[model samples]
Target: MTNSKKFALVTGSSNGIGRAIAENCAARGFNVLLVALPEPKLEEVTNALAAKYPNQEFHCLGVNLMDAGAPQEVFQWCQKNNFVVDILANNAGLGNSGDFLSKKAEFYFGQMQLNMVAMVMLTHHFLPEMQKLDKAYILNVASMASYYDIPFKGIYAASKKFVSSFSHSLRYELKDSNVFVSILCPAAVLTNPEVIKRDANMGFVSKITRQTAEQVAEYALSRMFNRKPVSIPGVFPKFYRTLGRVIPHRMQLRMLANAFIKQSRE
Candidate 1:
């Protein structure tokens, strides 16, 4: 039997921004389906949310989204369980920073698979069901890096660019439908110890623009629910995105290259 309750299915919900988003969804009275890698952390998060939101349903599946057919597997699992996912949060992604050629080809491929392919495929799988709902939402977590081509993070940035482009185009196509698509482009989210330490080394812009996972989650969900096309959590990131528009492409690329190169050395 199909579950009558609507769910918000969140990818990467074991930790960081994804976890924060999941908590928010539960708070807003939506049942949550948390998806992350198979690990104790995933179990912990699922248990924690279940305890915290006793009235709402909280289920989890541990799966590595980068694997082939993983998106389909997730869809199948939801189907078998009769979970009706009205809100799909594509928040799982891999972000690595280094010279383009420094990483092995396999690493880049896997990054692309997780960051771009998995997101697209998952959306493809869930979009039809979303369209059937009275109202639905797709929140894609991209990065402010999507607006620029950074030197050390070329592949990661490019993949996010793909996300940004794809999301906007999808939103256009779904404009007349019940499904609403929005993208969150946050800058320097301090989600963990490593991210906090990295933000310290990221200079003034990153520091000023940085946000906590909770902050990003709150802002993103608020804006997404309001049907905003793009949600930028911080003021500086919003300003920087606008600034990039007037700057010549060559100059912007050069500036970004220099900044990332310096950060890479630090």
Candidate 2:
């Protein structure tokens, strides 16, 4: 209320999909709080957005969204600065690709930390404030993995599944509260190079029907602003999800495994 412009907060917004979402939100007339780790790369993105969206205001938070203190810290920062967030986009996520037993439990926990836990924490902390307002939106960036299990990315798939389910149930829970939740599930997106480095198997996926970060952001935010419950951004992903109903799970898993193997080689 202190600032005349409506507010939105995007997590892990230094680059890739998160950064695109932050820029999209700003273009949509919402001042954005760009959250990322304390790094020069994060600062660089902040400076670029500030310059590009000169008409809109943006705040940068350098706290780890996966940390225990992140949710409270973000809330306090907003309150101190008198920024009222009408929209919250939970976009920060980490990938896990390896044999389940071979990988440490810490890796699985880290997936939950970024994908599931951080999202829940931020939503819990912000929902009360959002409910107070007459109109508000919450967008959770899930993945195509939400509906299926990735063979090597077992934990990553599970984490996204949590995000998809949690957002759906919470959407119903808050139905009468006037705070709508949008769960965005997009297929393989080739953005942050970190993913390619983390799992060399992702290289071949570049040839697949992958979406760009900007495309995902544009479509997702447009539908979210309209209060859509579930959004499948691109044409290919929506088609795949529909066809996946008839595709056997075993075959689906096999195809994904082969794709990973190909990426690794590339």
Candidate 3:
């Protein structure tokens, strides 16, 4: 990594929205440090991005963020390599749709570890170094589900709500600092085959609010740089979020529960 070039450390960046964010960062002149699970895909993405943006540096670290102490390990690796991370994108997360009881206890534990705990740990480990810079940014990838209590995606929604709340609080605390914190609460993103199929099966609302991974990444980075506290990528998602605010919480819960229950059965 070049000492003069800024770096964006992006988690879960081997595929999906994470990958798009890494690519977008490179396009915007930031060297990228891509973190994901140990897989050939990670190396492939690293090489591809390096070739595409020859002027920028692209590095990959494959480690499971859900494991204890993993965030510290990542920070140490960056320190060892002298990779100054100007932007921290805590984008790694896990989500599954099913009846809460249908999944094993281990599944929920791992989901929380990755979606909530890992995000917090990574931010904690990185924030001090980020604050030392003239300007830095932390982008937490939450979900539009953070705004509602849905039936089938209860755990995922709750985890994202934690992200939303944590990001807002942290951003407020750092209002006078160089560290700018933002959260991306995208609605339905068409990320992969499974996600595409799942979104196709959902209601009209999901379809209308759906965005491509690239679209979400573009919007998220723009908003993050602009210091926008919360970024919802699509027009329909913004509208839906506004509408949700006016509806009573009990009615919103019932409507979401009914819709998700029917969708799950189908």
What lDDT does the true structure give each of the candidates?
Answer: 0.90, 0.82, 0.90
Compose the digit string of candidate 2's lDDT tens values, residues 1-266.
64545688999899888999998887877788888888888888888888988988888989887777888898888878777888899998987665567668876776688888889999998888888898999999999888887777778888889999999999999888889999989876767675646334455343354778889999898888787888887777777788778899899989877755443333
lDDT of 1: 0.90
- Report the C-alpha lDDT of model 3 over 1-266, residue by residue, as the tens digit: 34545689999999999999999998998999999999999999999999999988999999998898888899999888898889999999987777888889998998999999989998998898888899999999999899998888899999999999999999999999999999999888888675776677775878898898999999999989998999999899999999999999999988888767755665
Shift of residue 183 alpha carbon in model 2, Å: 1.0
Consecutive 10-residue window with the lowest summed lDDT within model 3: 257-266
- Candidate 1: tens digits of C-alpha lDDT, residues 55-110: 99999999999898899999999998889899999999888766777779999998
TM-score of each: 0.96, 0.91, 0.95
The predicted structure with the larger lDDT, 1 or 2, is 1
Q: Ranking by TM-score, best first?
A: 1, 3, 2
TM for candidate 3 is: 0.95
The superposed Cα distance between candidate 3 and the true structure at residue 42, in angstroms, equals 1.1
Q: Once superposed on the true structure, which residue ranges of model 2 sit more than 4 Å away at CA?
A: 1-5, 194-208, 261-266
